[model samples]
Target: MHDSEDLVVVVDGELLTNTETICTGMKAQHASTMKLLRKHLKQLQTFGEVRFEIRLNPQGSDTEYAMLNEQQSALLISLMRNRKEVVSFKVKLIREFFRMRDALGQRDMTLWRQLQVAIAQEVDSAVRASFGSRLMLDRKKDKPILQSEIHRLESEIQPGLLLN
Candidate 1:
């Protein structure tokens, strides 16, 4: 609902990085870096959260950690929360709110399939609105696009691997 900023920390797969490293790196040269990052990120919105995703290597010997600032993290969390994965259906219903369900006639069993279509359209529109704008999209848009790109690659491999 509100706007926020996010700080992401991504470690290389071979490096076996995690939150501890980020905290350590930030605190190493400057002990209060995390505090600063958190403070700045929180100020971007009224309600914000932080998240960490670790992608382990294929050999299962190392792990790569991804740190997201609040805004970026929020967008990702929203996508993940709303994503109906492993589905053949291209359009999925994103009933984020109960009211949305009633509004889409979700209660009407007969309209269930139609509701899905509507939700799909809504999701497409929302994604386009958020991501389609070149002006609005940037490396620092909501999160570092680079980090997400790296994360995408990491997702393809098995966890607990040691990347070379």
Candidate 2:
């Protein structure tokens, strides 16, 4: 749908997509989509918040669009008068929306694993510094102890995490 453009996006940790996606997917004019949205604006809001943003294009003209959550977007699609094309696009969009949901879940799990590794690395670093400065005559013999601990943890931890 929508020529394979990204149908779903994460904004402020919220799952959302825009009206433009629907317009392109259904092969309808965006102007008509906006008109239908405005006509049923109240009905759309009944499902959830419908957000609008205005951006100045390269030509200095304002382009306005609505950023809708799952329910609002679904209802907006149902509101369209045409069905033959809209149905297929609507189905594709819904499926893609859920696919993105699962991907987000996987991302959260990966971040949690990364945090665990980072904590382990911090502990390893602290242990190394402390033992290295100790007044032990057999420190040379115990070098492998630190190596073993680091291996138990992992090879590396990224200095920072990425946020979306």
Candidate 3:
């Protein structure tokens, strides 16, 4: 649930604006907009930038609506009757789309960094486990080898590093 009236959602790496939201933003009736979209479905599909989904309504009824990416959304807006409200809505939608995109990018970057840290930790743990096994197998004979491995691992996992 988004608080912003002009909120645009990101679905499967694409910014999506549904028919209802578009109609509301444009100050147009939902039925009219849906009709227009259906009438022009072929043209929109030819653009290769829009997706349509069949979703179930809250009342358990099937409903079909077009989900448009940024490019397709812009194109659709351009093709619509150019009212002041529609133009203003288009501007807001574009802005929200970019903002959502940038936020998603930042989130992805953060998740990537976390994954790296997790992998490093797993590597460090594996190295320690190997060292422990070697120490148990050769308590005295492999002391030097174990020491060297420990030193290498310690250097690799320096203080404040990801592994540490």
Candidate 4:
């Protein structure tokens, strides 16, 4: 079987599958699938959040589609009886769910590192720009106070670097 990653959509940091895709995968009629979902809506909500998102078609018509996260999808699949294909498909979907989650986690870590590097560069630049000629020692009386202020600013920007 092919990977089902393309069939999954990420919505607001949650991996979701549309009812049309799930119905197609399970070889069930769309109406029947939707009926089953509505019947168990309460129970499914207890399991996890289920949402319906509205989208506009090319014809300017609004269509509401059900979106299910991994937990909700698994729960819905479990409710289906005597569907052998659905059982297998559920297993595959769950694996893909976790793979997507890991990918998202890696992306978050990369973004966090980039942010840290950006902050460090900005702090370094600010320190250099502020300390240029303004910190000259010709003004001996204000030199000590300026130096102490600079030290405090540096410590605030990056902890544990007190000047010797």
| TM-scores of all candidate predictions against the true structure | 0.18, 0.63, 0.65, 0.68
Question: How would you encode candidate 2's per-residue C-alpha lDDT over 1-164 as one tens digit per residue?
Answer: 55433887888666898887788788888778899999999998997788999877457888888999888898888877767787888888899888888877787667668657655655555666566556243444454664554344343222243221
- Candidate models: Cα lDDT each: 0.36, 0.74, 0.68, 0.71
List the lowest-lDDT window of 10 residues for candidate 2: 155-164
Q: What's the alpha carbon RMSD for model 1?
A: 22.3
- Among all windows of ten consecutive residues in candidate 1, which has the lowest summed lDDT? 1-10
Clashing residue pairs found in predicted model 3: none
Q: What is the C-alpha RMSD of each candidate to the true structure, in Å?
A: 22.3, 7.7, 10.0, 9.8
Off by over 4 Å in 2: 46-48, 56-61, 120-164
Selected candidate, larger lDDT, 1 vs 3: 3
Model 2: how far residue 9 lies from native, Å: 2.4
How many steric clashes does model 3 contain? 0
Can you write out model 4's per-residue Cα lDDT over 1-164, one digit (the tens) per residue?
Answer: 34576668776666888776777777777668889999999987886778887877446887566888878888887887756898877777778888898988787666566556655654555565567665333344454555555555555444455544
Greater lDDT among 2 and 3 belongs to 2
Question: Model 3 lDDT vs. the true structure?
Answer: 0.68
Candidate 4 regions exceeding 4 Å error are 1-3, 47-49, 53-64, 133-164
**Relative to the unseen true structure, what is the C-alpha lDDT of residue 121 in candidate 2, on a scale of 0 to 100?**
58
Off by over 4 Å in 3: 1-6, 46-64, 134-164
Name the lDDT value of residue 138 in candidate 3. Answer: 54
| Model 4: worst 10 consecutive residues (lDDT sum) | 134-143
| Of 2 and 3, the candidate ranking higher by TM-score | 3
